[model samples]
Target: MTSVWIMLVKKSRAILGFAAISIVAASCGTNAPQDTWQPKGPNSKIIDDLQRPVFAVAGIIGLIVAVAVIYTLIKYRDRGQPIPEQTHGKPALEITLTIIPALILAVVAVFTFGAIFKLAKTDDTEMIINVTGQQWWWEYDYPTQNEFGITQPIISSGQLVMPVGTKVLLRETSRDVIHSYWIPALNGKRDAVPGRVQTLRLEADAPGIYAGQCTEFCGLSHANMRMEAVALSKADFAKWVANQQAAYVAPAKDSLAQQGEEVFLNQCVRCHQVNGLMRADGTPAIAAPDENVWSGSAPNLTHLMSRNTFAGASFDLLSKQCRDEVWNAPSDVVGTKYLAGVTEECLNQKDLRSWLRNAPAMLPMYANATQLKATGGKYRGMPYLALTEDDISKLVAYLLTLK
Candidate 1:
């Protein structure tokens, strides 16, 4: 009997050890790109270091309580023994437990205060980017980013690009409802509220992609409002800036791409803009999106193919092979490989074609006729364009040339 009891204890310990190891391994998962446990920068590191010790202390306290309860249960088990009369609780023991918890809470309070101060220091910001949240997407604009050898203003959606080893401050606001921007690997969430600009400091220690989402429930398509921060090395970031600022070259005359350009001018020019394209009267064809879109503007597609993802970073633009060369490649090669965005042979045409056919069906958008009627005839996202298969083919050809 004694040998059997000892063996049972050993088995229990072994099982617990295996469980602990498995849990640790699972916490370091590679598939959860937005796992808060994986801190990639200073902001998230502050949060992790502050909370982990507190969690450890709490776990220790819980284990001590559990052991005490188990010991008492075994020691006081009934074995045809006399029942003890009920008595008043021990005042001293109660006092001790209360004091211990108060002390622990007090320690937690002090460390929490220190972390708040450390996290609040954002004066060292090297760049400022404006983030505007709307019904279904986020738009990022570099206001004073002269680094990366970029002298002109840069605007982008779906992907937020910043140079590695620098502090990028986001001045965030909303045009419609409230939305929260949270990139777990880099920093905590900050709310984007209408009429108020909130600030959050972001910094990346290395070059990679950090995925984020709108955590706050803002609208019907809130879950689909995803974003990615693409960190690039200095030289590669400069190359990206130069590419974005390069002159817009029109498609060759009489080519299918030029025909698609004409189609875009007819159906898409109201909301989308290809920079430097002129109207028939030679007037600059500035897009007037307020007439069609609810947010009063749309994503600029001037260098559309220069980006990797589309439709709020919810879809991949490059083929699997090219995308792997960017996403799964080594750090030294990531920047150079990603800069070569969406080549013709590497374009993912199937999804893009479907998206061009019916954008609202692909992504949740308040753009159907009934919803538009209810919302005073304003569309909250890209509506179905009812494009023919031939039109979709031509438009894809033209958009491919925008790079």
Candidate 2:
């Protein structure tokens, strides 16, 4: 009997040791980048506060439970005696158990509520960026900035540019369905509902690029609806704003770019707008009305080459090594490399060619010929304008000059 008990104890100890080793090995094997957890903004402070106390309390509770379990196991181990008396539960013991847990919960609730109110207070925001969500894309409007002091709103898409360390308040809404705007490194997710304007606060303590995706599934390409928030130094942000506000520069006369512009006006202008071009009488030409288009917002490709990626930042603007080289470096290095704007060096020509050929096919969308039959055969997101190889080349040439 003694030998059998010794063998059982040894086997149990071996199993426990194996379990511990497996847990440690599994934890070490996780390969997610360690740099992701480091937060660099005001909103990150809220994340820190919320996680810290919860983890601390959980750690304390876990330690207590572990110690109690070990003590009970050792103390109550089988001994050479009859079974101990099993008594009914004591009222005092039950009351103490309930009261302790309740007290701990109350304490947690108090701290959690305090933190919620602190983070929710958005009274002192200096600027507001109106973000409108749509199917498979995002549109940003700087309602605070006046264009050349003319008070015309500055609107763009795909990239959300902001100055570093400045508190930015986002007023978000959706056009068709519910969508969520979430940049995990910076803050919590905020839902953009169709009829209501929801507000979220964002701040970047350092100048760098942060990637985001739509948390709410909207349509065919919800997974493809990605975005980037670029935090720049004040001066660089001002420069970006100036460049964005600058009047469109027409391609040189009689160039391939000029031909591309003509092609765009003839075929693409019905859904897109190029700022500088006008009618022969020097008057603005209105885009042909397409009621099927959502919010009349297409990505403003003014500085197309200036950005690192396009088409919702789903594809890399540069080669894989180039992107890794930039993103892996520290903030200072990344800021310097990406600040100038997108250039030919970073352009993904293959994907660009594919996109110019047929955008809906390249990226999934509900813009098929059958889907558009209800809307008088008009394109929903983007049309597959039947362009010859020559026309595609010309259009791509014109798009490249947008920078």
Candidate 3:
């Protein structure tokens, strides 16, 4: 029995040694990628700065605790001697411990309050972008575009484009439930409550595309709700604004696109709006009627092809190879070329075809019309629009011309 016990101890030590080696190997693995803490905007900078002091304080506290534990383990260890005397209390030691932690906590509170106010300040904002959150999509409206020569409000979806180095204020709110807007590399998150207007400040130091997802769990498709902020140089942003402001072009005469336009008016016009298309009142229907969407309205797809991604930035605007080719380029080259907007070459024909064929099947949403009826004709998200193959082809052809 003694020999068996000795063998078990030897086996345990061997296993412990192997585990230690594996841990060392994992820590120094050559294949491990370096962490990329990319900071694109001002809010990220503030967060990073605040985190540094907190981490420093935590490190100091951890080191002190570790040293004290090691000292106690060694000093109080048994050495085949008499047991040490039991003390009632050490008042001075207890006071030191309590006071030290209280002082540290007070310092932390001061730093926290300063950061909170700094992040929430929005007094010097140059522009205000009204951001509306819906079930699984985002709407961006330039409310004061009239001063910039735009006759009406410029609205778009999926991507938020901002001029780099500008302090832009975001007035965010939700249509239904609560939603939170977050773009990690660019800024901190802010909640969009249904009845409350929350202001968020955002500024990108340089031109780049930063990705984010909805941090609030609104519903089933909450995980799929994503967004991107495209930070462009002032000149490039101006050019984009001009392109977006351009009047919508009609489909060519005697083309299948013309028939598709008729189909769109018959079926889709109720929910969507294409500029230059006239309503029954003979006025150009540039905006979706306010009552259409459960939110304010669906996105204006007039410049749909101008943005690279769509469906709330849930799908890529370009193919994988195309995105990589653009993203892997040098920084200066990448910023100008890789804005999340559609180009003539990178359009996803297959996905777009499928989306038009059956949008609900392509992207899961609360869009089943029959199921909606079961719930007393109430649905929060987009509903399915049954369309024939011929209708889908015509729709795709028409959408292609949007570019």
RMSD of each: 3.2, 4.3, 5.1
lDDT of each: 0.84, 0.73, 0.74
Query: Compared with the true structure, what per-residue lDDT tens digits does model 2 show for residues 177-235?
Result: 89999886688789999999999988998887777889898878888888788887777
Model 3 pairs whose backbones collide: 307-341, 307-342, 308-340, 308-341, 308-342
- The backbone clash count of each candidate, in order, is 0, 3, 5
lDDT of 3 by residue, 1-403 (tens): 4455456556555655765566456435442221113456777787778776776677567656655655565555565778767878999999998999999899889888888898888888887889999888898988755434445677888889888888989999998778899887777789999999999898988876677888899887898888888777777777777777787788888799888877888877777777777655777765554554545467667778777676777777677777666656665665567544565467777777677666777667776545665445445565667789899888767766665
Candidate number with the higher TM-score (1 or 3): 1
Q: Clashing residue pairs, candidate 1?
A: none
Off by over 4 Å in 1: 1-23
**Residue 211 lDDT in model 2?**
76
* Tens digit per residue, CA lDDT, model 1, 1-403: 4455456557556655765675576567466878878888889999989877986787667557655655565566665788787888999999998998999899899999999988878888788889998878788877745555657777788889888888889999988899999999899999999999999989988888888999999888888888888889988888888888898898999999998988898888988877887766777778877887877878888888988888867788888777777888777888888788888999999889999999978888888756567567878888899899999999999999988
- On lDDT, the candidate that comes out on top is 1
Name model 2 segments beyond 4 Å from true: 1-36, 59-88, 146-152, 279-281, 288-290, 372-380
Off by over 4 Å in 3: 1-37, 70-84, 146-151, 279-293, 326-331, 334-341, 373-376
How many residue-pair clashes does candidate 2 contain? 3
Residue 346 miss distance in model 2 (angstroms): 2.2
